[model samples]
Target: MQCSFRQLKEKSLSTEVTQMQWNPKMDLLALANTQGEVWLHRLNWQRVWTLSPPTGTTEGQGVTGLAWRPDGQVLGVGYQNGQVVLCDVEKAEVLHTSTLSHPVSCMTWQEAEDKHRVTSAPVHVDQSSSPVSSQATPQDTAADFLPRLTPLPKGYSATDKANSEEEIVEDNKRLSSQTRLNILVVGDEAGSIYLLAYGLFSMGQLAPEEHPQAKGGRLLSVTLSSDLQCLSAVVQHQASADTSQPEHTICLTTYNTSLLATRSQELATLAMKYGQVATILGYMENTLRSMSEAWEDILLEMDNKLAKFAETIDNKDPDWQVSDEFLQLLMWGKASPELQSFLLNTLTEKGLKKLGLSIDNSYSNIEKLVLNHLQRAGQALLFHLSELKGLSLWYDKYGMLGLNTQAVQEAWSCAGSFMLKTNELLQ
Candidate 1:
């Protein structure tokens, strides 16, 4: 494929660009500058919208990283003050903000593969059970194995349960052909890596998990595999006192995305479940609060106006009759009854039913989310226990190889303790 590039004139931006990212599924590009400004631009170089950081102490911090969610609905901008803000580009509104301990240096967004295909697809081989085969036939490729997971029987062991749960969690992270679970991975100058559950972030909550620290360095870039199982980072380490030049290091990290996804999925699910209730109550609370404040303001204004009117009366003004009527209406709280009646009459049977349907749909979605979360939790727990068993087996093998097993054993013990704690929490 042939590609072309276009240069934007300096007039297009007020300051030099610090970072920029093209939307994965759109012709748009998001740019951030040294002055802490973010702008969206079309591929044709047309300016779209400009966004400034929320006004506060961190407003002066520079923009450090930019990432677009897979669906291209929101842009994630990281700042030098270690704050990440998700913005709805079209609306020019802030969706969510998350803070880190150090300046954000790099970021990457990724989606997992489809779970159904990964779990059900047959294993491909060169030939049907051939030890040495140079070519594979279509029939050989069609050979199948059992699905990645099977339904657990009643009374399964804890290990079996943990193993099954882990698999399910992993499977849940995979993206389907049409759907996506957008994940945001951010790295900072402090050598800390953060994984954000994008769905939760969009919901105004920061669901983040940290990875093992890297060697001291400023992170240059971060990337994730399509499967979401592996992460790679580029770090630029400062030179030591004895050296005249700086050195760069490449750090490759592996993680069970499924486990992280499981945690994030659970959080999103729970938030949705409780958020419905909070939403209804919050709307009512805000409405009443605003109404009360408005009334207070009106009363205060009226008191001052009335005091002035009394002085005008003492000065023998003839306009006091009109002012008296207005004050009487205001004090009676009976202004515009016709408007209230009109609004009440507007609530017809059809309108009422439509409102009911909307509420029901919200509840239905929350129910489904909760059920899915519970089922996945069980599966993930089972998978985790199975993994622990496998680790123990590997530890035995390492012992046979005459490797020092004390550290391994201690690690295993710690893991076991964690599992026990988790189980206790569940119970």
Candidate 2:
């Protein structure tokens, strides 16, 4: 089909749209609005599903990006506060939600080739007639690679004997089979892209082989040079519009990891065996830390601004004026207990009442607001806390906690306490 772009709606209810994605089958479209809202529309532009923010999101956090899984079974929406919400497309139910430090700017999926092939340990077939011939036919080349098949044992059943012959012939044909294409590429905002292959298994695990040497022979080659897949990562340089033409041009950056660049296919194979799980765990943990730090930074910045405002207001000349920026900063987060007391001390009973900043009388109101904002912070925190809890549960259930005992235990302890505290405070 020809490529076409159509506008389903002239104006989106939310002013800012940060990301958009179409399903793999191109039958559905998803839009992330800056108002912490996601809308799923059918291909012909019919509104279908609308996902709302979990209640109690802070003022600034908003929807930032969206991605669809390869099979179009799931939709993942990212938020400015570094949260990810995953939805099941068919049921329209939210399945998983996560938070990262930096915002999730992008997501992509990678699929890899099935490199496992049936093999036969070839035995030199004697060509007594015209053995000196130089040129080789296609069948001759195939025969050279084919394994010397052994006849069925006397006790073998008819079905087993018949299947063994068929499998041997299939192996012989595959020895000289043409090359096939099966690979998927995925890229991320962390300046990295990965290639992955699926369905890789050992031939010994598949149909049986007939050669006498098959006992020690590996049905599939483990050496990546001739066997596994390859992967590559290329960086790109972003240039200003003034220095470049209006036409779209991508400047490829020099690769820092030749291991992935030169042997990406092999890397993909190894990734499935043991490395990918570690990489994914690292990605999840690193992202969660980054999101936590971002919230911490925001709170710290607000605290610093409030401190500077209080100092200036106290030391400045009686006629000096306070800036709106200072007041705005002061209005954010759980008002520091110390700052609340300071505001109460600096203002008169009437002035404090007017500003609604009296610590003694505002205790009830302050607690209410604190609970609200804490709930907001908790919404993000809980996302990570639950993920940690889930990981811990998996580790305990599967008995895989031994690999990273210290880290996993620490995570369980900290997150468990955090979840308890948050629930307590919220209540």
Candidate 3:
């Protein structure tokens, strides 16, 4: 059977259309222009919302790629400066944004799945929101760098999994689930592809086997198969011999969904462990800060005591100027060698007693400061030991999953040894 098409409507835009994508489940069509602007249009060609580029971006550095989340709630826009903004469509707010090292060339969002294959019915959305006319003829082949929509496999739809409102609420809370894990695949101008687990907030580059001809190129587009078993990219490069004409190449990479799932789990675990470590470190920092403040207090107290003692001596012995000089010598060690010896030779028993008491009080303050510092250090060490024990348990649990736990064991042993040394010092 032959398919027929007819013109529906048309709308004009002020800027050139750089990229666009239709929502998988709605009539909304997202469009990007050369001015780094994103516009969402309904099937009736009415504009729903417009998102401008983030502050500090140049007008020439427009959006390079765009993708819609499977739920049609978020739109991911890739810019020339390697920034990806995930915008909430309904609220017209920026939900999340990430920056990469290289300029973003293309991007695609995928729903997470297992290794088993599945199929689903094709989703048909209205084309009136499209910049091109609906009556336009279809192309035999899509542009090399442009992404195309593929129907998702069956048994993977979010609606199918959650039939009730309560179930959907529960599923929404489980953002890390395979069903909720929206993987954002980004290709850059440096010919590198990155896999970002949006739910886990972790990202890593995909390093494919080398192809000599494909060494230096700018990725034009990236698309994943319906099952997500394969990823294909279009790369454009300039040949050394032919500078005037650009060369284009297609690269196909296949991956196991199970491996990706395991990797996402590991990333989440590591992120949690690192967060725990950071909290402990922050506690230690606060303790150290407190100790510093305590030391400063001791210094201030000593200064006040010495000043009071000098004033009392001056008041009590108006005729004896030596008393004030003697106190100054003791407090600041500023007396000349001759004066020091003379004072020592002529010092009275009462004066010596007064100096001794003052020195004793200052020494007591010093001792307290030292003890406080030691106590805080010991507490920090104890907390560290407890954290190490928890890490050891984590290692034991994750070791069965083929992760390396030898480093964790080593750290645990080191903590134990340090605790013993600390105990000896305290004793």
lDDT of each: 0.51, 0.41, 0.55
Q: How many residue pairs clash (N, CA or C atoms closer than 3 angstroms) in each of the candidate models, in the order given? A: 20, 13, 3
The best-first sequence of candidates by TM-score reads: 1, 3, 2
The count of backbone overlaps in candidate 1 is 20
Considering every candidate listed, which one attains the maximal TM-score?
Answer: 1
| lDDT of each residue in 1-427, candidate 1, tens digit only | 2457665554555688888899887889888787778888987789899998657875537888888877787788888888888787677677557788888888888765443111111123233533212132112111132123332222211123533543331222121121334568888878777766552333221122344335676778777675555667666666677876656445555445444332322222222322222222333343334334434444444444334334433336564443344446557865344323432564456754654454444334333322333333333333333332343344332223222346445644654564465356345
Best by lDDT: 3
- What lDDT tens digits, residue by residue, belong to model 3 across residues 1-427? 2558766887788889989899998999999987788999999988999998879855436899898877777788888888888886776777556787888888888874433211110012234533122232122111132222111112211222322323221112123223333567888888777876552254456543453333587777776554444667777766566465445445544445444544333333343333333333443354345445544544454444345344434256556454446557668989865455544654456665765666555444434433443344444434444443443455533445443456656755764575475456445
- TM-score for predicted model 1 compared with the true structure: 0.50
Better of 1 and 3 by TM-score: 1
Model 1 residue 245 lDDT? 62
